[model samples]
Target: MLNIADTLHDWCRAARPFALATVVQVSGSAPLPVGTALAVDGDGNVVGSVSGGCVEAAVYELCQEVLKGDAPPTRARFGYSDDDAFAVGLTCGGELDVLVQRIDPADQPHLTAALGEVTSGRPVAVAQIVDGPEGLLGRTLSVSGDGSTEAGAGGGEEWEAVAAAQAGALLRAGRTGRVEVGGDAATCPERLSVLVHTHASRPRMLIFGAVDFAGALSEIGRFLGYRVTVCDARPVFATAARFPHADEVVADWPHRYLAATEVDARTAVCVLTHDAKFDVPLLRLALGLPVGYVGAMGSRRTHTQRLELLRTAAVPEEHLARLHSPIGLDLGAHTPEETALSIAAEITAHTHGGSGAPLSWSTGPIHRRQSAAR
Candidate 1:
């Protein structure tokens, strides 16, 4: 949702005006969420997806109309109908309501500022429509890195400010929250409720081996939207040309670099160095912290040897268990890139609270539906 907002915000800021289409309501099993958006530029390019592909063409037509100023930002209704059995909407036969808004730069100060921060790789919110419909679909609550804020809700400033602050925190943390903005609790006329979806900074992947596997992880991490970091004790392999995709190629020791950051559940640490001398101590340091993922590469025998070494170094048996040795989900990959894919997949599963189960084997929650209802 935030990604779509950022793109449209860019379109508006550049004064290259675009049409913003968002799924405002859904009934039954929805293919997309209420806040799902897609931006259609003046040239008809799409930046994001709203449905599986169902309403994109229809939405495109609406987008053209919006750019021409032929229509107000109105809620579009589409569902399965008796007349159109072979309809232009979801094959799942769900109904969706899309709100197409023509964003004006003059009216969207808060959204513009928010997108500027996001494009600069900073976390921010582009809060839209909690109330009103004319510009409600474009109304914004934007905050800066230092927490200075601005919003267009004049008379309802305090309530909107509080909602924006709470929503901004959730956005910075990369999650979604529903907030109620009301001043008079006894009997408030305008209750500004919001479903704020956050746009967060990209997760970091710190690969602790500057070897062949580290090089591969760096490339794969780029596709996974990670700020990839390759670290090693030896400076030779950490050269820029070797891991060009990496955001940082550090020649520093793995343990030393790990000490500098608060490794959280969003950060992934891969110990590709199999040498117990370099790898074992680093494994202890990684699992000892709150990092999201800890993958160590080796055969089963090699893992056993590494585990014993960790124990001798005073790392608890339970802590050793946290290491994903013979690392990666069982995709049976042998090549370097394939192995990197398996490891990255495992990292994604770990961070998102997934069990790494096959989709076919999984019953409900077939995929993590990116929606407000979830």
Candidate 2:
């Protein structure tokens, strides 16, 4: 699966066959999301995980069975078992539907190509027939970010096209989920269920000031799987040596660099300049963009002044409300590293719709199901 693309690609390049068990669906308090995978090679080597630690032993045995060639591509379900404590199930009281299949590069060229795209950092979605009629099981169709598609051999051409289109729609939204096709009068006559797993590029985290705080934030952002970029007008402050963890250190005007960069709905824009000349113009542009999070570093008084300045400059009230000025949670953080943690926590809360309160103080499900748009 794309989640462990690098290891899978390496196995493929070495002409090794492996069995992959991917989580295609989840219900209740599942710890891992769909698209999570576990792969087992012929030598009994394993990489990746499906449900943290629970249900892994069962999934691993399934992978081994799949690699032994005795079993065909199959689906297995695991859930909590109250009647039997020794049962092979999840302790978290959640359910997962896992699809186990073999990946041999010589036999599955389409999957090899898809894995190559994922390891190369290109956006791609692979739709596999998880459930379908005979001769259609394990059929795959890969859709690239540019809208081009390639279907694997064997399966009806009409079904392949439908799967490709569905994969493309899911890729555009950067989501991984299942789609039911066929059996419909408008599409195909046979019923088929496809699981589309999208491998999108890492979301961007644009830090608009290259200060001590920026250095700390760049590390945290990278750890959180963001493509971090630190930008500032001061060349001395924006050097690569200052923020070694940053994917890119740009010595350009904050607003100019931001205007030229690519931004999407998943991108997070953090303005740490704290200066009127840099913060005002840069934030004015960032607030208008369709980014996920836009936070600025400042005190209450500075935030008040910045708001008045933006209002005077004709910025809309709706856009202004989206800004998280006097940024970060009420963590009482003093050091730069602590401040970065506070900011990251705020951004995560915003993204996941958390109340930013302590878990002990909150009731109900600890893990909320995030939107597909995320």
Candidate 3:
């Protein structure tokens, strides 16, 4: 899918006037999450999706209305029931609230710059006054990774300070949502609800194996928007041709490679080389790192042996607890493709704090705690 910034960059470069429709709020099993956007240009070209395929036509019409000035920057709601007189409703049984606005570069300078930063692979957050007085409607302010503001109109320095601080916090969490903030001190009654949307760099997934399962998992990881790298000590097996989906293929010892490479809080390390010499050292380093996930694929017996080696290596008890040995969910997966699915599903569940239980036995919101991005 094309990201919001990609859509904006394409339209701006083409000098096209378009309307951007964003799903700013959703309730009850909505197809898409907040920050999902769809752009429609004057030529009726559509890019991106919000609500999957259920409400695009309705949103497209709303975009045209905003582009034609028939509607001001407006919030359109779609409910599950078709009982309403409106021509469109979400058949998927959910509620979606979308904000449609014309993207005029001359008027939305900060948004333009924010889009550029996003397209250039820099983290940025755009805070838009979604609800407030008429004068503040459609106003936006953006903050980049280095704590620099894109500089736009919203309120006085006080308001900017609060909003920028909030934006920075949300950026760190990679969260997007509405936050209530008061206007200038003198106009305390002038409250505003700002929607802070954060765009962060894609997370990384390092798979230390060149096996068939590693290849399948690499493809799945890339599909999930992760930068996947496949590394193995044996050059014969660690060729790019073996793992076509991987972003990088390195013919190096897993432990030596990880010692020199960068692993952040968003990186996932998969130790698939079940050989004791290779996986033992690799996993010892992986578990000690602050990476988001560290999984090693092996059998129950192999895992028991590996654990003994890690303990002998003096890996802290808490760090050993972080390892997902005998990796992947209990899906009875016997094939490479199915095993990949199980591993990827486990990683996703871990990342989102899921129970790995069936939805039939689940309750509460289907989406994760935080809203999804475009």
Candidate 4:
């Protein structure tokens, strides 16, 4: 979480002793992902969380010891079993591997380097492994960097190497990946989960259109935490005054802007330019690449028209189907902001494979609010 990052930065600046407790592994319907984080200070103040109120107290205690230099950084496990009914275990019957370690503000130039990349709105991955006892507990390893890798703490031919390498790859992709180690397939023994966090500071949202809905969508997109860009050729309406929330107001044609940026699988492009002149070309550009979400604002009839245009443009129907036209879900949203929420909801649904249905109508585990923070 950003709070953890900021806190860590401030603590480092103040020369206060602190340790980071990161949830590096999760199993069997866990509440958080592999990279979910929590910070424990010397005074026992906590920021962020690793589990559903099950592991914090234990991890925090470890933090105190780490701060006192009485305990070395290392990996600790928490899970639920019938035997651990009142122990430091998951009440939800899941498992997590936490790496708690003391951070030497003096030796944290590497962390601050990575943090610098993040603060500048760039993406960087930080990898560390805490296993075994203190003294040699958690070691930071360098796997990749656009420039050079600063030395991390761990290295070996078996579990450590595999863990660092896999985590490095995931960080480059800005993703979370799981690694099973030891000679079951490779390595020496057991499985080690490497949590790779690719910290991309601000996400960009590209909107194509100069319509009223475009303005509304831009505002809503900003609300949903996007660095909104309203790109349209018409200078008349693509002004900052019209869509005040947009971070950038570009009076350029859609195709030109699309070609300029690296709008890969993480960017969201919404084509509110319903006319063929804009939508068709923009759709071709959108479909040609792998944007995270491609939404076109139009009715069912307009969607058909766009499809026809695409077909005539020799765009594949398979690619054409990727566009979510009549864009949002069937929420019957009439107002622009409401429609924007529906579209955002649909985008979330598409990305996470949620059904966009009520929670009571679903089965299995009910996702808590904390889990959604990740």
| Model 3 agreement with the true structure over 1-374: per-residue lDDT tens digits | 12568878766766677888887778877877777889988888888888888888989998888888635688889877667634477776678888788776655576777888888988999887677776666567889998887656444545566678788888876677778777657534578777888887778899998999999999999999899999999999999888999999999999999999977878999989899999888888888888999999999999999999999998889999999989999999999999999999999999878899999897766765454332
lDDT score at residue 54, model 3, on the 0-100 scale = 82
Model 1: runs farther than 4 Å from truth?
1-10, 14-19, 24-35, 40-48, 57-85, 92-97, 130-138, 153-156, 176-192, 308-321, 370-374
For each candidate in turn, the TM-score is: 0.80, 0.91, 0.84, 0.83
In order, what lDDT does every prediction score?
0.74, 0.88, 0.82, 0.72
TM-score (C-alpha, index-matched) for candidate 3: 0.84
Best by lDDT: 2
Sorted on lDDT, best first, the list reads 2, 3, 1, 4
**lDDT (Cα, 0-100) at 41 in candidate 2:** 99
Between prediction 1 and prediction 3, the one with superior TM-score is: 3
lDDT string, candidate 1, 1-374, tens digits: 56566676667678776778877667755687767788777787888877778778888888888988746776687776566666776665677777787766666666677777766778766555534535344455766656666776353544566666676676656665455655465433356656665567787898988888778889999888988988888887778899898998888878888888655557888988888778876888888887777889899999888888888899987777778888899998888888998998898887766899887776653345443412
- Better-scoring candidate (lDDT), 3 or 4: 3
List residue ranges in candidate 4 displaced over 4 A. Answer: 1-3, 28-30, 52-55, 74-95, 130-137, 142-147, 153-168, 180-192, 367-374
lDDT of 4 by residue, 274-314 (tens): 88998888889888887888999888999998899899999
Q: Compare candidates 1 and 2 on TM-score and give the better one.
A: 2
Clashing pairs in 2: none
Q: Is candidate 2 or candidate 4 better by TM-score?
A: 2
Global lDDT of model 2:
0.88
